[model samples]
Target: MNRVEEPLLSVSERRIATRLCVDAPLGAGQTVGLAPQQAHYLRTVLRLSTGADLALFNGRDGEWRARIDALGKGWASLAVIDQRRAQQPEPDVWLVFAPIKRARLDFLVEKACELGAARLLPVFTQNTDVSRVNCERLRANCREAAEQCERLSVPEVAEPTGLRDLLADWPADRHLLVAAESGHAPPVAEALARAREQAGGRAGVPASAAPWAVLVGPEGGFTEAELDALSKLPFVTAAGLGPRVLRADTAGIALLACWQAWLGDGDARPPFRG
Candidate 1:
């Protein structure tokens, strides 16, 4: 009989093997206790037993190789053996989108974390269907996405705010990219390039060095008053996604991908090791 060979795991799959993010401090030879929920997730969901080796990361400290020292019904502990990778600096990008349905909102948050968004803001627009958003659920989605994507840090999820309030308190230095549904606006790439050029002229730093934030409107798109207000803002750049109008969630993902490809680390090499 011929011997069979096992297929090798992909880079992303191998990186996510028994990997978790804990909210405790990590150091060499440090013993960290897992929260009750985390313990349940490991023992019940993952079926991990004591003495199992797992990788851990806390946003601040880098990734570490740890072993499960103790496992109980509601308690677990891990011993850090060594650091695997150092924490890398994330892109200074924020995603602001109108709150839509529950399922799509969760999807948006997860994808935002995977795509290297530093912050997530929920903006309530005039046409927004959802009146309230559960910020905790979004944060949990971000954590799960970060762990699976091998990201060093999870994006910060902010509470939902009205569109008017968000713009009223907009920062002067940060550039805002508005996804325009109208065909009159320029393409997203052109707008980004123009914003970069203007930023470079004002500041000595390169275009990629400037902070960026993307705003995607609700399904119905921004109202006339909202568009007029955004147009008046000096930091806002209106850009069209394409010929056809996109759904709220799709538009958010497309805008983030385009910005990352042009200015963020989309073209950069992957830092994750198999």
Candidate 2:
């Protein structure tokens, strides 16, 4: 029987750390009060008493270590001890997906955050089954996933928009990677490689320089007219996942993983400085 070696933990994972994404400002020696729901989570659900240490991040500021100072019936207070990590740059990858059933949509949002997507945009396609989406719930899912994954920032979850509207106002500089369910489309890796070459020299460039996005359609996939419209876009690249068709949730996760591996922060070594 061979023992499987576990990968080394990053610097942020060594301690008995619990993280919370809060709305309040954070600074050293600053006292911040938690919302009622957040306080309930820490005090009742987590059984964390006063004087316990936890980490906090507001999506804008970096991670901070805070000590619980007071635990009242419906609220809790914490004093910021120090900053853990300065705000780090995340990949400039946006995940745009057509909303599906409730459970699958929740899964998609969670996985997107763990994969370091900077934004999650829901687009309504012609074949999209789920017309309505709860943006607030999706935002909560993103925050929870970020907390569990030790991510310093939470992906911004946007309101659902029509595919036509999104394309009409799409930024010219941002590259859109469309997940093609058809067989004739190029592989995801190859498509990303081509986009990278067109953008600059190598892959994994700084987020500011090369902003990229992945668009996954609904379970029934895109209609011919919709596909044609997407294909005609100059900034869009149609890429296939594999030979077999994948569920909407699976395709979204697979596409994101491919993009991160090819041009995002999936590398083991530090990205080239020069």
Q: Please give me the total number of clashing residue pairs in predicted model 2.
A: 0
Predicted candidate 1 versus true structure: per-residue lDDT over 77-151, tens digit per residue:
999877778887767889999998898989988888888889999999999888999999999899899888888
Clashing pairs in 2: none
lDDT of 2 by residue, 1-274 (tens): 1111212143433343588998888899899998898899998888999778788999878888788899987799999977767777788999999999999989999999989899999999999988799999999899999988888889998888999999999999888998898747888888878776766746567455788899999988999999989989998988988788899899989999888887888763431112
Tell me the spans in candidate 2 whose CA falls farther than 4 Å from its real position: 1-14, 199-203, 268-274
Against the hidden reference, what TM-scores do the models get? 0.89, 0.90
Off by over 4 Å in 1: 1-16, 196-208
Candidate 1 local lDDT, residue 237: 83
Candidate 1: lDDT over CA atoms? 0.83
Give the whole-model CA lDDT for all candidates, comma-separated: 0.83, 0.84
- Cα distance off (Å), candidate 2, residue 127: 0.7
